[model samples]
Target: MISWDKDFKIYNFKSKYGPWALVAGASEGLGAAYAEALAKRGLDLILIARRQEKLDELSKKLINEYSIAIKCLALDLSDIAHVIEVLSQIDLPIGLLIYNAAYAPIGDFDTIPSDDLAKVVDVNIKAPLLLAKFVSKKMIENKRGGIVLMSSLAGSQGSPKLVTYAASKAFNAILAEGLWSELKEHGVDVIASIAGAIVTPGYQQAQNAKKAPGTLTPDQVAEKTLKALGKKPTIIPGFTNKLARFFMGRLIPRKWAISIMKQNTESLS
Candidate 1:
């Protein structure tokens, strides 16, 4: 069990980081949960996603419930230039940035279209790189801030069907770790959240199943992530996930790890 102080107050967040946060992929699932959690912590938000209606609805709900400021940008992360432009216009200093947008294309490497592969790289890797560059500059200038990059267990090893997706997440994880080392001296905290399976709409759609064993709820993942921010360079959300990663990365041979991962992912397919 991953335990934290149940009585830990949200004020600690506001005091350490600033009063505003930016959350990408905020329409649903873990992104939405992050937005809600930040609101409860008394931070205004800038929400980005592809769905306009969903963004509007979420903005209204959070504003009504939390009474905090919110700006919704219904933009696709795949559009790199437009995403940069939109972010450039945010007048508020973003104290925290959660790069949660990702695309996972599951299939044989050759069976997947080239365009689909490019799109995954664009959203999962390029967008985060650009956004982090933009936000960390401001955070560095301010002399204090936080960033959370949403990575996955898939990033740790070869995933047969989720090749490009896993590779992209590996990029995210390594990027965040590098930034953490560089930024910590400047008073900015960076964390790569190595998540396991979570019960989100996106997960359901990707797996074409109702639920996966050992999966966590989106809220559980978000809350835990928020609590752990700025405390570590990387975090694996669940105890089971932590154990699995340790054994797979250390205890077994590289060939055996890849083979086991292939078997597990093939079962999902």
Candidate 2:
């Protein structure tokens, strides 16, 4: 396990949230952490995940602990058409919408099939963008709300073994920035977060198999993300990851920068 110092600017929310917050991928990982943090801020929740049982269990804990309203939506985001269908069913005035679900497969292009590529694009790129489009309209009509998209550090540069994953994140990063520019004037905030490696179940399993790095914890990432929502359109969630972005931004040559990324990915296995 790798341990590093974390920097946090924990701001207290002075006013309680009105209506509800919808969190996709709320059954586990950083998404679950965000759900808990928002609940603590007095926002009622609408939790979405593929696992109904897990969503129900988490909803119970949030309601029992925070005494806030909790709603659960079990969704498989892979079905693009059904996402819109699912959201139309919710009647609550959603004050916050967070699209946090994602999937990734690690390997070279030849080894990773076209079907896998489409799946990643569907979840990491298409789903979040569609969700943003739908929710932005709702927030627009309401005239006040916040929407956050979960992006990743892989987005900042090319990821060789995870080529499509990096491209999908880049799409999200740009989409969030563009939306933030457009929506802020309308009294709605659109924020995208680039999360670093975190101590979630997926990361833990990757660690056990010597695959992914053990970086920041989910709570640690969540704390930074919450602080960044209103102030900036885009945020990188850990100290090292922030520094990485800063240096990556300064790279003069795109070819050289992507070359470094390719080397890093080759070293992973």
Candidate 3:
């Protein structure tokens, strides 16, 4: 585990962002990593995911380790209404919102089932967008809070085999960019972590090949992204991913970049 860098970011997290945080998709992998990082920083957490057992286990572990209050809920993020209903019932004033859940269907766009694509839209696009809408107003009222939307480096441009997933991620980054500007003046921090590959359990299940270059651990990405929260609209965690974004976004033709992505994501197909 990468230890927190006090020298790098010294925000009085509890004071500036309130006492409580809510992490959607908090059952495992990157989502669980985000929950851990925040828990270590002394924030009480409201953990949400689809698995009740996993949420219960995680809540027990975190409460044991950090001695912080926790509330765990099992619900599908795709059902935005149920999620909102649950959120409303929580008496705690959640000051930090982390939307880490995403549905990524990896294959040629046309070959993939329409229902899978629709699931992607509901989970990846609708959930985060609406959660941000619901949470940000309270942040604006409190005059300080944060929102972190997980995106991907693949979302920077059109990735062939990952078309639907990439497109959905692109929606998140753009949403965060717009909200960062609109919400910053209200003292609410917003950032999109346009991350590269991470060695999470979900990633391992999906990937058939060896670890990709510059693959980071979930903790590393979580730590770096949280550190960068109030500082930028978006962060690509790894240096390799940052370099990739620079070349793809600034140093090449659009067609050339897309072609590069085709080769890069061919394995995913």
Candidate 4:
């Protein structure tokens, strides 16, 4: 177990890396929480999301309150070419990258449209892969940086209703673990933030329900995630989530885990 220092200053992210951090999916939910947390830590930001209005409002709020440079990029993650073009034009060196955008299509795998599944792959897998590849190069040169990929508990099991989404998150988790091993030598930190049910707008919309008993707030997850950077290859946000992942991934049989997941997600059917 990694011992976390209670007084560790998260603002040290600027000292270890650089001045700027780029956050994908920064319009709302955990993305917006990350933006707020990072801003509080004194880092300039480049926020990207599909909604221009939301991004603009967030950027203004951060800029006014924190007195830090904020750039809002409203673009679809599925548009690889446009994303690449916009990122390529940025003059600042981005030392921290948070790939938080994801596509979760609920319901049976066969019932969901093929195009929707493909979009999930593109956003959750391809976008992160490309962004990491692009950012790691600059990080390797500087010999200091951090990357956080948003993963899910579903990723570790065969979630029936969220099959494609689970698979994509698994890919992200593995990628982060491998990169953490490989990049540590170069003074770069890679983390897979394995999150459970969080009280976010997206989650509420997707589940069509209010926050459950054990669900975490976005701020809570964001704070914990930032604190865990450079400390572990993977960090499960809440203690309850951590325990659940441990039991589901280790103690329980794989078939049993899948059965439990299927039952839990039956509402999505």
- Count clashing residue pairs per candidate: 0, 0, 0, 0
Q: Roughly what TM-score does model 2 have, to 2 decimal places?
A: 0.87
Which segments of candidate 1 are over 4 A away from where they belong? 1-8, 208-210
- Model 2 misplacement above 4 A: 1-17, 207-214, 267-269
Alpha carbon deviation, residue 253, candidate 4 (Å) = 1.0
TM-scores for every candidate against the unseen true structure: 0.94, 0.87, 0.94, 0.94
Candidate 3 residue runs with Cα over 4 Å from true position: 1-11
Clashing pairs in 1: none
Worst 10 residues of 2 by lDDT: 5-14
Task: Please identify which of the two predictions, 1 or 2, would achieve the higher TM-score against the true structure.
Answer: 1
Per-model lDDT? 0.89, 0.78, 0.90, 0.89
Residues 158-230 of candidate 2 have per-residue lDDT tens digits of: 8888888888888988999998999888778878898767777765554233434426878888777777777
lDDT top scorer? 3
Candidate 3 Cα lDDT to native: 0.90
Q: Which candidate do you rate higher for TM-score, 2 or 3?
A: 3
Per-residue lDDT tens digits for candidate 4, residues 1-269, read 64354224544667876588999999999999999999988899999999999999999999999898998988999986789789899767899999999999898887999999999999999999999998899999999999999999989999998999999999999999999999999999999999999888888887545454468998998999888889999999887888889999999999999998887777752
Q: How would you encode candidate 3's per-residue C-alpha lDDT over 56-156 as one tens digit per residue?
A: 99899999998989999889999998899888887688889999998888888789999999999999999999999999888899999999999998898
- Per-residue error for 47 in candidate 2, Å, reads 1.0
Error of 4 at 75 (Å): 0.7
